[model samples]
Target chain A: MRALCWHGKNDIRYEQVPDPVIEHPRDAIVRVTSCAICGSDLHLYDGFMPGMKSGDIMGHEFMGEIVDVGPGINGKVKVGDRVVVPFTIICGECEQCRRGNFSVCERTNRNKHIADKVFGHSTAGLYGYTHLTGGYPGGQAEYVRVPYADVGPVKVPNGLSDEQVLFLGDIFPTGWQAVVQCDIEPTDTVAIWGAGPVGQFCVRSAILLGAQQVICIDRLPERLAMAEAGGAIPINFEKESVVERLNDLTNGKGPQKCIDAVGLEAHATATIDSMYDRAKQAMMLETDRPHVLREMIYVCRPAGTISVPGVYGGLLDKVPFGMVMNKGLTIRTGQTHVNRWTEDLLGLIEEGQIDPSFVITHRVPLERGPEMYQTFRDKHDGCIKVVLQP
Target chain B: MQNAYGNHSGSSRAHGVARGLGWFSIALGVAEVAAPRALTRALGMDGQESLVRAYGLREIATGSAILRSENPAPWVWGRVAGDALDLATLGAGYRNQNPQQQRNLGLALAAVAGVTAADVWCARALSNGAGQQARLPMRDYRDRSGFPRPPAEMRGAARHLSIPRDMRAPEALQPYRAG
Candidate 1:
């Protein structure tokens, strides 16, 4: 099977690997039809998250047809069943999965010992992510061995194109969960940082969930414009002050809910704290940049909520915990429990309320995944999302 | 708005040069700090060791600023100014220098001249925005909202959706409430 493999920092290759087989009784072999380069994948591409081995397959957002299933799967999933595999690999029967906290599912991470040492407790296993999660070969290939196949792959009904259902495996539900965790009220103004794909979804999700006003912040003109189209007031942080503009929009009060979709790789170049982070990062003194996190803590309304759908790894320097404490902020953050919201989001897609395909700015063959990684990382050619046809 | 680095290569290359220069600055500064006596002895400026160390501190500060700052133009310009001061100090030592000392001073002056040229060039490139500034796009995307209807009508369209109890904010923080 041809797959995208991780070599080192900033190096992804399209190479041939052995085909996958049913590894366990509950496992399934999926022949990938479509995949995407996600923002979090950039974290791995940039070599931020550790534990990735050489030649490890690289992808998480993908959907395809099942070619084979283990005997334990029984008839729940059969061959030729089209499905979108959620990024998180879940055992379905774990306590966390039972509680709908699938991102923290107790039983899926094969690397639980390593994760326990690093994270105090292991979270759910994820595809094509680092070994800290399950080092499961991801869906970026022609075929992938899904460890907990029956639990994670949501069956896609016929008539829905791969584009419409693809993101249900990740970004669509991720954005949805980011907003749902905000618990938005009708009169609340929601401020989201980062206008990337997840951020775009955050805008649409916030609106659909009934926030009174949605503000999307980014330095990119095209992304901000897209956010505007999605019923969000676009704030180009490079042009005007985010703090002042957000305050002006909210009548001198800060936004009631803030979402940091930018995560570890925030690019607030003009700010002193970002400079500090870059300096520390270059010196290997800091692991992640928390510029958006700092700004959110500073600007969120007192007693408001801060929901982070962004991926952050390792230590952050100089976070303003004082502001968070004094303001009485509620910070909710995690990897998305994708399965918990896939059904609702699938209904939304089926109802014609929103189209996840709108986020895909570029589509290409799986072979071009390496170049697409650079194009997407650099945000060249107005590339918001790149969907790969494997 | 037009970004100075239209194609992005120039900006990326400029940042690469700026980073190289930053590391160079720190390396040169460290050399001076650790062995000011060696530099002074070579130049025959026996009493100027302390001054050499002071300039080394300046170099370290400037280098740190360049490496740490997103914009390195001003810091590069600072390097140019520091180069000028170094030349002036070396030239002032020329009056009392012996033949061997003059040769070493001349060599020192040429080395400073070379670095000074790089500093000036890097500074000008950065100031003109031909260097490491972000390349903002001219592509318009105001129409790419993912909604089926106009956003105004679609606002709160998913209100029928339920918010899980654990996910909801405390009652006091809810803006719209039930009687």
Candidate 2:
């Protein structure tokens, strides 16, 4: 099989590799039909995520048909069933799984050292993320082995197309989780910190959940425009102070719910050291999120909720504590539990409550996975979301 | 009533009742202090720890359901305990904490539970200790080996059950199906 391999920072290639087989009883082989590049993939493209060697296949967001299923699998998902594979490969019966917390599944990536040896250490058992996710080959290829298929592979609803469900694997659900965690109520006001794909999803979700006003903060004209088109009030931090704009818009009370969808790679201006400092702070929250958390405290109303659904790393820097203590706020954050909500999200899509395709600004072939990674990473050519067909 | 030893029979009965009341009071006190910590520990360290803490405080206002004698502590504890069990087993990096921190959290939870149990025990002993000569409610020791779910419907299960919204609307899903 041919797979797109990550060689080094900004180095990805389409190469021939061994075909994947059912390695475990819970595994399934999926023939890749469509896959997309995530903002996180840009980490490798920009040489930020370490440990990438030559020939590491990269990609996690994908949808495909089940070409084969391992023995002992019987969840009514069978051969020929179209499925969307979740990025986190979790065993359904583990302690983490019993509580529906699959992101940190014990059995999925137990041998992190060995897997990282093969893929990368930044990910646990991601499909194409190199060493980060057990270095298991990714779906940016002709075929890929999906571990814990019964738990990881969500059966695509009958009527939905692959493009609609593609983001379900990561960004869509992540964005949704961000909004959901904000605990937004009817007539509540929300401020999101980015307008990327995940940020856009957060904007739409905040509106869907009945926030009376949604303010999207970003510097990209295209993304800001997208946010406005989606019915969220747009704020360009480059032109105006986000805090001031939010204050002016909300009459100085601040938003009731705040979400930081920007994660570690936040955009900043030349003069403001705080934005760069905040990005570093955002990274620390990857393990113990304190920086963005503190920012949420500053920008949110007292007693309001803050939700963080951005992807983060293990180590981070100084976190703000005094603000969090004073605000008497509720902070909720975690990796998105995609399996729990895929069915309902599918229902909403079918009902036309959300159309996620608006985020897709570019479509390329699987062969261009490497190039898409660069374009999406640089945000060049107004690349918002890139869908790759195999 | 007359005592065989020529002591006042009413005094003997009163003394016996008082001793039983003391024992009941002590038992209640122990339970009140122990209950919250046990429940929190069982739930593991996650969002549930905070929830259990809030519930522990609320138990004072709403009164305790632990005194019902059918062993409701495990159910309450299970709601929180079950939340983190899987993460514990998965070798989650968060669980790879400094051993001291892990132990400290455990001790804190135990202390909280112990305090909760003691409070309940004391209240029960003061109110109903003399009237009923019932056995002190025993702690229902759960087998850590087996997973625990509450016997009754857990409050706030709906909130905990919420999944992240990554899946797209059915109409938006068309692209993936495109060959």
TM-score of each: 0.87, 0.64
Residue A30 miss distance in model 2 (angstroms) = 0.3
Docking class of 1: acceptable
Model 1: residues with Cα > 4 Å off, grouped in runs: B1-14, B19-137, B171-179
What would the per-residue lDDT of candidate 1 be over residues B1-179, giving only the tens digit for each residue?
23232465555556667777876787788899999999999899998888989998998888778876757888999999999999999999987888999999999999999989888877887876632344453567777877889988888889898877878877776665468
Report clash pairs, candidate 1.
none
Residue by residue across B1-179, what tens digits does model 2's lDDT show? 01122222233333333333333433434454456466444435443444444544444322222222222333233322432332343223236556755665556556545544544444444334323323323212121101122211211212333534432222332223446
Query: Which model scores highest in lDDT?
Result: 1
How does chain A of candidate 2 score by TM-score against the true chain A?
Answer: 0.90
Q: lDDT for model 1, please.
A: 0.89
Q: Could you tell me which 10 consecutive residues in candidate 2 chain B have the lowest summed lDDT?
A: B138-147
lDDT score at residue A64, model 2, on the 0-100 scale: 92
lDDT score of residue A155 within candidate 2: 85
